[model samples]
Every structure is written in structure tokens, then in C-alpha cells.
Target: MTAKFHAFLQNGTWELVPYDASMNVVGSKWVFKIKRHLDGSIDRYKARLVSQGFTQVPGVDFTKTFSPVVKPATVCTILALVVSCGWDIWQLDVHNTFLNGFIAETIFVHQPKGFEDNNYLHHCKPSLFIYSREKITIYVHVYVDDILITGSSSAHVSHLISNLSQTFDLKDLGPLHYFLGIEFHRDAFELILSQRKYILDHLLKINLAAAKPVSSSMATSFQLSRFTREPLSDSTQYRSIVGALQYVTLARPDVAFAVNKVCQFLQSPTDEHWGAVKRNLRYLKGTIDSGLIFSAHSSDTLIAYFDADWASFPNDRRSTGGYGIFLGSHLTLWRAKKQPTIAWSSIEDEFRALANTTTELL
Candidate 1:
């Protein structure tokens, strides 16, 4: 508590104020955490003081309306120079930092109960400006999905169909023709999987599933942001399409990264994010024939490659790491994940990636 309090004081996170009867006051509480070593021994105890910020009023307390210091032109100019001149790119991650701006409002957090400090007077102003880094608070949007059933047995399939027909309002679409947008091709040799019909229907649903297919998964210089000024009104449609694209990744690993990036803004999708999703879908339109192939070949050898992008995230500047593992010359496992801790250097980030990949190999 003392360490955190002193750190807060040094950071100037908030100013002490007197108890005010007229203005609304916010409450705060202490949070506790424990850090442990690799051997599971206790390393240290951590405490944080968090404000109950739900009490803050919109107009009276703070205003988020502000202009960006770095204009769109500046970002484009820098990127254009890099593309043309082939410049080296560098990134850095610095935590506990904010773009400190002056604010005219004078709001305050109330003093803790029973702690009478002279500095915490009745009416005091605390927060000076909004921090550039804010904690992620996710509000997941829910959508209902239908279950698709499949198995290999004429007798068993018939028995299960009789049971389901007895239990609920069942429509017997014989031979597993098409269920939940997935089309199946089965014969004596093997059963093939494809979403050609589903993709086409959804494309026509959005009036672009059949549009000219693009060669790229996503266009170069794709601009996406969480704080985009213009938000799409059909955010629900965006969410649904993104969800479908996620299912498509089950069969198509090529578009996984692009789809994963777009899925981040399901709750509040911007027009830019929606456009990126459409680009990915258009890519899928070209590669609808792409599907996983079943093979009997097996090998005992395991091969893996790991890499990391230092300070990849624009919002928090956190590094991202990923690895791909191949067993017997076939891809068995692969993942792309963001690093938990910020890396100070490229070497540090790559070392962390190696460590994580080694763990996965084990």
C-alpha cells in the first residue's frame, strides 16, 4: 500500500481534496495481488487503489471530446516514406505514461472513510487530464447459434433421427445435405468439407459475396481504430459476419490473423474495422475452394518456428509473439498471441518468444 501510494504520488495520479457536500464524490477501494516465482514461492504482495468511477457525471465531471495531435496526414506521410525509401522501423513500449493535457473541470475523489488527512480537504480537484492508456473493459455481445450434427452410420443416424423426431419439431433433411451453412461432399473414399454455398449466400446477403475476388487477404495500408469518429450503424451485422468469419477460420488458417484482428471490435465496430472484415471476406470469396485435407501420413519429428513483433499494439505498445509447430512435415499446431509483459528491446522480445516456444515444444 505504501509503495503504491508513493508511486501514485510521484505519478501525480490524483490530487487530494477536501470532503465536498455539494459536489458528487467518488469512492475507492484497495485491491490485493500476489506475485510468485517459478518455483511457486511467494515473491511479493501487490496492492492497488482503484476508484469507484461509476459515480462520475458526464457533463459535470469530464469530456472526452478532443482533437488528435497526430493528424492522419502525418501517419500517411511517415508510412509512405517507409514504403518508398525502405526505412527501418522501431517501436517502444512505456507503461504508466499518459498524454497529459490541461482540463478546466475540477472534480475530486472522496477521502477514504476514517482516514482524516489534512491534505484531503472538503473540496479538491484530483484528475488533471485523461490518460492515453486505459484498461480494457470488454462487454461481449451475445448471439444464438444452431447446432449441426454429423456421424458415420446409416443405422445409428436413422435411430438418432427417430429419437429426435420423437422429442422435438424435427425436419428430416436426409443425407446431411447442408446444415448451418456448411456443405459436405462424401463418397466411398473420403468426405470433403466446403463452405462455398454459405460464403456465396452471405456474400449475396451483403451484396458483395460474389464481388470481384481480391488477391490479398487484407489491403495494404488498412486503417482501423477503436476510437474511430464514425461508427457503423449495423454493428450487429458486422458482429454476425465477423462471427461467421471466425467459423471460417476453423477450415481456413490463411485468414485467421486478419479475422482475429477484426474480431477485437465486435462490441463497438467502426466502419474501418467493418471494411477490413469485408476485405477478408472478399479474400475468402476467391479461396472458397480452400479447405483442410485429411491424410494418413505421419512422422515423429517435431519442428517449430517462433517470432515476435516488438511493441505491435498501437494503443498499449505491447509486443506480440507467435509460433508454428509442424509434426512430420505437416502443420500440427500454431498460434499467435500477444506477450503479457512489455519488452524493452527487440532481443528481449525474441528471447521471450523463444522461451514461450520452448515451453510449447516441451
Candidate 2:
């Protein structure tokens, strides 16, 4: 706590002031977290003092809320391009990210509980920043404080790092081994991206670490319906695990269909839906190392494959359709979702899937 307060003082985060009853003072609290490495080992402990923004009036204390976030597809597409082009991939982290932002609001917050220096202070995201020029392009993708950088030339990329270091307290993490929960492993021929540790961590969270692994994400004979089985007495865990599984699909497209099936019942999930969720996790347990592979020698030819399950949903007779898009030999994008409307025949369902795929291709 002392160290955190000292760092806040060093950053000129806030000034101590006498309490005024007329002022709309906000409360502050310290948040502590453990920073872990890709191997699930502790790296360091972190502390941050944040304002309880929930206490303020929206239009008065704050007018608008905006955070710049890069799309998952954008990151995957660029990564594939970089690997295919034989470019360098680097990672960076900006310290005290919240202290660097420019704020126009006049706000006051109570001093932290334990280390009150008789003062009050006021406070604060694009996830991606890119620089591109003719024959030279540098991509600086920021996920909060952590950044993933890649470009055409190693020299220019290092120059950018030097410049960034001079401007902000930054750490160049050298090679993009990990970024935004995805781990990158590079070799002579291909770049393998996976979430092995991420999967295990979540599996342990739900106490499925020792469960038997399954080869398939879903049961081939299982049917999904809103009214099947008894409704879960509590759906919080079901919803939470399923949501995490949805993110897992970012790298494991094979489970996309299974995840989508369980997600349909999120509003009121039943025991059967919960069981489906566990099955997906078990599948992940067996294939924790599975991920997208980007080959260095692959072509840039874009190809797509789409398919549909005709009248798969017994309740509504709606078909589920999905598509996988490959950039060269790398699978960069894919989605598994139920069709918007019912189709009478399998051929019509397939055509609808093709139309969706074509739209995504463009």
C-alpha cells in the first residue's frame, strides 16, 4: 500500500485538499491483483487506487463513455498477414495507463482509507494504435496497457519502441509470446497461437480440472430445447462458464457450434444446457494445445467454406449455419450461429449460409 501511494504521488495523480461539504466528493478504494505469467506462475503483485464512479451523476459528473477496442478479427487477420510476410512481432506494456489520459471533468475523490495524506484527488482507452507508411507499416495494437507490435522492418520497429519508451514508462516485452490471453509460439515454418494455460485456469475455476477429457465438443445425439429437463436452481455458474467458453471460441472454432447451442438457453438455462457446457469444457481439456496455425510460406489466396444443418432445432425447426474463412493456409475467421429464419429444405438452408459467408468475405 505504501508503495502504491508513493507511485501515485510520483505520477502527480492528485493533490491533497481540505474537505468541502458542498463539493460532490467521490469515494476511492484500492484494488489489488496478482499478475501471472503464461505458465500460470506469479510474476508480481499490483495495486491501483480507483474512484467509485458509480456515486457520480452521469450527465453532470460524466457525459460520455468511450473506450477504443480492437476487434478480434482485426488482430487475427493482421497476425496472419505478418506471419506470411515474415515480419517481426513484438510486445510492450505501458505502466500507469490510467495516469496518462487527458480528462476534462472536474472531480474530487476522498483519500484512500489507510494512507490518507489529508488530500483528495481527481481522475481518467484505445486497444489498438497503428502507424503505416509507404513500404513500411507498423501495427501497435494495445489491449489496455499491454501492446502487440509488428511491422515490415525490424530496425523501424525498434525505433518506434525507443520513441515510445522516451515518451511513456514502457517495457518492451521483446517477441510477442503472449497478448490479450492468446499465446504465440513461433518456429521456422509456422506461428502457433493457443490458450493452453487460459483453458486450464478456467477449467479449475469450475472444478473440472480432473474430469475425463472428450474428443468431441458436443454430443452427436444430444438435443437442445428451452423446456427440456429441470431448470437450474441457479444459473450464475452456467452463464458465467458459457460466456467464457464463448471467448474460448476465439481460438477454438471447433467448439463454436457447441458453444452456440448452449448459449441459446442463457436466458433460462436448464440442467441439460449446463451439461452441454461441461462437455464443451471437457473437449477443451483434451485439446488445450489446439489453436490456429499460420504458415510462413502460405499464400494470400482467400477461400471460404460454408455449411448448414437443416431443421436442426426441433423446437423451432430452424437450421444452424456456419462458415470458416481462410487467408492462404491460415484460418483467420469463423462463426457458428443459428439461422435468422426457418428454411423448408436443406438446399435453401445451404444457400442462406453461402449468402452469409459471401457477405463476410466482402
**Strongest candidate by lDDT:** 2
Model 1 ranges off by over 4 Å? 1-193, 220-223, 358-362
Which lDDT value does model 1 have at 285?
A: 90
What is residue 106's positional error in candidate 2, in angstroms?
Answer: 6.1
Report model 2's TM-score to 2 decimal places: 0.84
Each prediction's number of clashing residue pairs: 7, 2
**What TM-score fits each model?**
0.47, 0.84
| lDDT of predicted model 2 | 0.84
**How would you encode candidate 1's per-residue C-alpha lDDT over 1-362 as one tens digit per residue?**
66555545566767765564677777767777774432346756756566677788777777665642332222222322222332322211111222345779765666543443665456443111112224311111111111222223334435544664453334334443343344545444333446776676678878895588889887555545688767888798998888888777645657766776787788888878888888888888998887643223434567889888788667667777888765544444556677888889999999999999888778
TM-score, predicted candidate 1 vs. hidden true structure: 0.47
